[model samples]
Target: MKRIVFFGDSLTAGYGLHKPEEQSFPALIQRELDAAGLDYRAVNAGVSGDTSASGLSRLSYWLSGPVDVFVLALGANDLIRGLAPSGTQRNLQAIIDQVKARFPLVKFLLLGMQLPLWVPGQRAAEFRQLYRDLAAENEMPLLPFLLDGVAGIKHLNMHDGVHPLAEGYQIIARRVWPVLQPLL
Candidate 1:
């Protein structure tokens, strides 16, 4: 089966307390692919609290062989922790390069995140721009604001207000399915 790797942090990992299949976006995407009769698999390579740096470290292990698609959804914790944006960009670029090198025909879909626009600096803009830059450079599919209508909404997020609830996952599935369909 063709494999689709969803590589990222807590949201992708479904960290907000629930069944893996129901909460994780990858599982939802899997169900969608199944219903649509797409011969593909969604592998959740998400590790809660992981940064783009951590994603880089595990790249070789998870990408040891040919992969049909890679959904890069990392860098959130790095942003929350106030890490340098340049480092995040470099790590992601490296991972994309490595994946393309090993699996030349592998398709990529870059998932971007957002932060409070009033966070008191240029951080949100810089972080958001990273996806645009990488997508342009690598010619990959780009999904702006992965959380979209779900983030910060009381009912959709967990008590911590960072992760998504089950309903939020549904919203995410609805949003991502169209973009993911063509890549599969």
Candidate 2:
């Protein structure tokens, strides 16, 4: 069976969710794939608190098996930690390059994250533009904002206001479905 891997940090890991495997956006995507009878398995390779550099470090392990599609969704932690956007972009690009080196035909989808408004405007803009640049350069799909409808909504987020609740993940799943469907 073909495999699609969602590689990222806490958001992709379904942090704060009681039943992550069943409620994470990747898991929901798996359910969609099953219902559509697609011959693919969705692998959730999300690690909480992972930065782009950390994700890049683990890319080799995830690339060990056949990967038909790779959903890149890291960098949030880097943003939170005030890491340079350039560094995040470079690490993300390196991860993609490594994956391509191993699986020349693997497809990619970049799930971009936005820094909260509190961050400096210039840095935030740079961080936001990185994903667009990467997606264009790589000729792959890009989801501009992973938390489009769920972010800042009191009801959708957990108490800490960083992670999404189960209901929020459902919304995220729906938003990601269209982008992922074409890939599948």
Candidate 3:
């Protein structure tokens, strides 16, 4: 069986949600795999409010031994906290490099994040390009925006509007499954 590690912040962790096992995006992906008769494990490495640096810090824990494919979803918290975009990109790239140093054959899928258009367009564009540039450099499948169709939708997000609701995760699962299906 193949294994895919999902590394991300609050979104991956399904923060503020009433249930994780039922509503977490990773779990939803697992269901997809099951229905497709794919023998795969979707390991949820999500940490609530984790920054890129934080994800890098937990590197050894997730990348140890062997990891078939990595679902790298991070940088949102870093952006929220106004951390340097270069730092986020560097940390993420370093993680992939380190994993390759050990596993050599591991594949990757990076989940990109974005800020609202109301924010400074220049800074936002730079942030958006970070994912694009990194994915291009690493040749990883990049999900342009993890919150692509769900963000800013009143019914799709929770009351806090920072996290997705059940329906939102379903949408996320649907969007990601296309790229993830063959891998599993």
Candidate 4:
């Protein structure tokens, strides 16, 4: 089966879930692929508290295997830690570049993230635009925000008010399927 790597932070890792292996968005997508008769294996490569730089540093391990599609969902930690958008974008771009160099035919689906408007300064706006710019430069399909309907919804997220619950992941899987399915 072909491999689809879901690379990101705690959200991709399904942090705090009782069964992340089975309930994470990547896992949910795996089930969807199976139900749809798609011959693809979803690989969750998310690391909690990981920044884009960390991801870039550890990318070689994920690249060891054959990759058919790359789903990038990083940068949340960067935003939380108040990192520079330029650095985040550069690190993310490097990850994509390395993956492309290894697997030229691999498709990419970028999962975007946004900061709350309450966050002071222009950083919030810049953070939001970086994803769009990256998608445009890479010519990849972009999911405006990974937590679209789930974010800020009391019932959807866990107590942390950051990560989502299983139901929330299900919503994410649903939102991702349309864009992801077309690529497959």
Model 2 misplacement above 4 A: 116-120
lDDT of 3 by residue, 139-160 (tens): 8888889998999999999988
Model 4, residue 105: displacement in angstroms? 0.7
Worst 10 residues of 1 by lDDT: 114-123
- After aligning candidate 1 to the native by TM-score, how far in Å is the CA of 54 from where it should be? 0.8
Clashing pairs in 3: none
Q: What overall lDDT goes with each candidate model? A: 0.87, 0.93, 0.88, 0.95
Clashes of each: 0, 0, 0, 0
Q: Give the per-residue Cα lDDT of candidate 3 at 26.
A: 96
Candidate topping lDDT: 4
| TM-score, model 4 to reference | 0.97
For candidate 2, the 10 contiguous residues with the lowest summed lDDT are: 114-123
Clashing pairs in 2: none
Give the distance in Å from residue 43's predicted Cα in candidate 4 to where it truly belongs.
0.5
- Candidate 1 segments whose C-alpha is farther than 4 A from its true place: none
TM-score of each: 0.95, 0.97, 0.95, 0.97
Off by over 4 Å in 3: none
Candidate 2 TM-score versus the reference: 0.97
